[model samples]
Target: MEVSYKEEVSVGALVILGLVAFTLGMFWLTGRSIVSKGIGVDVVFKDVSGLKEGDPVRVSGVTKGRVARVHLDKVGKVIVTIQVSSDVRPHADASAAVASADFLGAKYVAYNPGAKDEPLAQGTPIPGVAEEQFADIASRAASNASQLIENVNRGLNPGQLAADLHNTLVVTQRGMKALSEASNGPMVQQTTQTLKTVQNVMARIDSVLGTRDAAASGRRLDTLTANLGQLSAHLAAATKSLNELLTTMNKGEGTLGRMATDTMLYKNLNATLAALSSLLTDLKERPGRYLTVKVF
Candidate 1:
């Protein structure tokens, strides 16, 4: 069929539109922006964990751009070049990591803006962390479990354990049997008899001490206690009297107090005693003078 000019023009226009749409779709599918090259960021990781070019680049869990290139440096570190959206500017303190996008092992570059107040520097390299794959973790865990099982097998012998347990039980049973026999022996019986005899003697002693005698003894004790209490009171009174007498003497209030405290009175007493001694001596020397006996 010969196409009309208008139809031809329409087909051309449709083809052009389809091409443009396909280009845009591919860019979108590859997680790239059709606008500018966007901001470039270099991220270095120990290993990318399957991260590759065309992988989505996320900023704070949001898809922002796509990884443009991935290569290993001379130092064997994987460097990822990402072109993010114009608005995806991150500070110098930002962090980048290889993140798992799906269970099928699809990977992405996950970034954190980190401290929004920090200054953003262009083309600065961000340190990246390699994501731990679930399979690796599972493999390590399985290895550890295997090692533990092997160690248990090497250390533990079931036959030896069973034999040890049986020996222990047998020894314990024998000891218990010997103990039971000893508990029922002649010495045990003698001890029981001795205890019973002592109990009987104590009972007999209690019985021999009559209730009347006990009561009488308790009454006598009470009377003696009362007499002792009276004696104590009398002694206390005597002590008080003696203390008062001493206090009176110290104060020079009674005659003895004056004699004890007055120096002049003491001197006078001493002089009188000396004079009496002199008179007695003179009288002794002349017995007739002192002994004028009226024998008439």
Candidate 2:
């Protein structure tokens, strides 16, 4: 049976619509399966750098899940919610980082499970981490390469440096040879003679010190010690005597001290001298007055 063009077009359109609906249903079912079987967790990154929804999530280089959504929070943080398999327990201390999968800038989420204890929970927000960007790493490497080139430019050639060291060694060797030639023979003989003279003098001293008369010298030293002891005792006795004499003088007890310190003795001595002088003058002027007993 021949159909109308309008009817045929309507049938074709319905088939296409059915295929589209079936594809949509399959996609919806897949999404629900992923959500139910996988655990969902939120991650915040400082810079996602080409990350998008449906990117694969990896744990230790193995693909575990995919990113569900990428959105900017109220605070302008790039929050990436990821769905991971429930069979794999991610640690609470696990970190989520954005990483490149290939050279074509295919980005993915990397989960580093730190320890077995304290597993991560669903709907928890992982803190944003500072990731090393490719541009920054390249810039630092360029700077380091430039500095290395500058260092290489400033370096000296190895051949020239070795030649300079060789020249220094040659000069040092020549100087040592000249010094040895100048000091080799006569100076060495003179030094040897001087050492021999010193040895001879030491030998003479040892011989003299080792003689039998050295024993007599020791005996003389003992005698000298005894004499010193006697002298010290005499000195001590003299000091005692001198102290007694000083005590007697201080008390005005001795005749010499009285003569030195007594005022009455001084006056009597002066009067006696005057009387003797007067008698001497009288005898000198009238000799018969003192010599009259000589006549018969």
In model 1, what lDDT does residue 11 have? Answer: 97
lDDT of 1 by residue, 219-289 (tens): 65665556556555655655666577568766877665665556577579779999999999998899998
Candidate lDDT (C-alpha), each: 0.76, 0.71
* Alpha-carbon lDDT of model 2: 0.71
Error of 1 at 184 (Å): 6.7
111-224 per-residue lDDT for model 2 (tens digits): 765586987775678875645778889999999999998787668667778988986775455444433654544434545555565565556555555668967757655655
Q: After superposing candidate 2 on the true structure, give the runs of residues whose Cα lies further than 4 Å from its correct spot.
A: 1-37, 74-76, 128-131, 154-296
**Hey, what RMSD does candidate 2 come out at?**
32.0
Estimate TM-scores for all models: 0.56, 0.44
List of clashing residue pairs for candidate 2: none
Clash count (model 2, backbone only): 0
What's the lDDT of the predicted structure labeled candidate 1? 0.76
Best by TM-score: 1
